[model samples]
Target: MNTGDLHLLTGAYVLHALPPEEHADFERHLPGCPSCSEEVRELAATTGKLASAVAVVPPPVLKQRVMARVAAERQAPPVVPRQSRRGGTRRGRALSRFALAASVAAAATFGSVALWQYQEAQDARDAARRTERRAADLASVLAAPDAKAVSGGFAKGATGTVVVSRTLDKAAFLASGLPNPPEGKVYQLWFADGGSMRSAGLMDVSGATGAAVMEGPLDGASGIGVTVEPAGGSAQPTSDPLALLTLPA
Candidate 1:
């Protein structure tokens, strides 16, 4: 019922070999346990891939061969010694609780690792999707009859110009006057259409004049915005945007 036991059964669960009672218990637990569910999902995905890579069928004589090997090795001495611990009944109960707690902690650690890996995989997939969308937008812009290279800058100390040309399915964001981010922080670029925003990429603000070029299919995109975010940009902007450029839609 706890995480450690779930971790121990992850492989067997993926293989559909868990005992009926344990399998039912896990099904009930997984819905409320995000970490364990994530691990199970990732493990299942991995095992599915492995299954496709190899076709393994035991040979017809495998049972006979296994029996022969077992007979030859049966002569070996017992590896594990049989021993019994001496303890009070109360001490034994305490030990049982200790073991359960330890198992839970172990399961939590494993669940964390598995969830982290799954997140990495999900991020990679999102990035790929963004790239594809960007490409399509650029292609559309470049195909426009009036599309030509245009350059513009801010009215005050803020500076930079974007080269927008319908001849190419892409736009370049060139800027300066942005301050460098503090440790563990980053400048993030965003694409805005009327309804929502999407992360373009994390920008480096270490230099006086910073330029992060984003190439994506604009697909009726209205403008570009930049903000200070954590190391990785979020799906939604949390603070006021540092700069905004109206797209030559």
Candidate 2:
């Protein structure tokens, strides 16, 4: 019915997650949109590889949760960027959290402090690898050669910024001094193209400041718009925007 964000359905189509009606819509959509078609091909190929790589398939619920998280958020945890207007270091908090997770996982597995200490070297290496990978993913756009950052203001001292890199096909949405989203709503980003927009996933914002790596690529998107959407992001923005920041060509 609503083919507005048919591009966002690639993942669902690949996983057979779309409802019958929406599946029909997407099938109709897949013919003409090269980007969505290409994405579906790549994703389907990857899905095949992953399916064959594992000896056993995951439970349906686990698969659903994984797909939901990827489709909904696809965001890095909130971290103050190096150029944060509020003026703070970036990366440290995220890295610390990763290390903390590693230590917790180690403790849970070993169940004894001495046992954890015995495996300290191996665990530390695992933690280092995890943190490195996460930080790299989060900073991909920020560190890109063509990265550009823009800032704008919001009501009640709140402010927003967007950093984009067409080269990296990524963008980061950052904000400060905003209230938590209304109970069932979340901050959603859009790739503004003229009057139309496409979903760019959701953010996990919780306090005075937040930052997230937006979902989807930057091509064809003229700017970024933020809005409050129902929990697992929307196919299109449903509310007035909290901020709109244009990107350079």
lDDT agreement with native, every candidate: 0.58, 0.68
Alpha carbon deviation, residue 46, candidate 1 (Å) = 36
Candidate 1 wrong stretches, greater than 4 Å: 1-156
Off by over 4 Å in 2: 1-134
- How close is every model to the real structure, measured as TM-score? 0.38, 0.47
Global local distance difference test of model 2:
0.68
Distance from true location, Cα of 187 in model 2, Å: 0.8
TM-score of 1: 0.38
- Per-residue alpha-carbon lDDT of model 2 for 131-219, expressed as tens digits? 68756767887888888888999877899988888778888888899889888888888889778998887776766777778878877
RMSD (CA, angstroms), candidate 1 = 18.0
lDDT of 2 at 173: 84
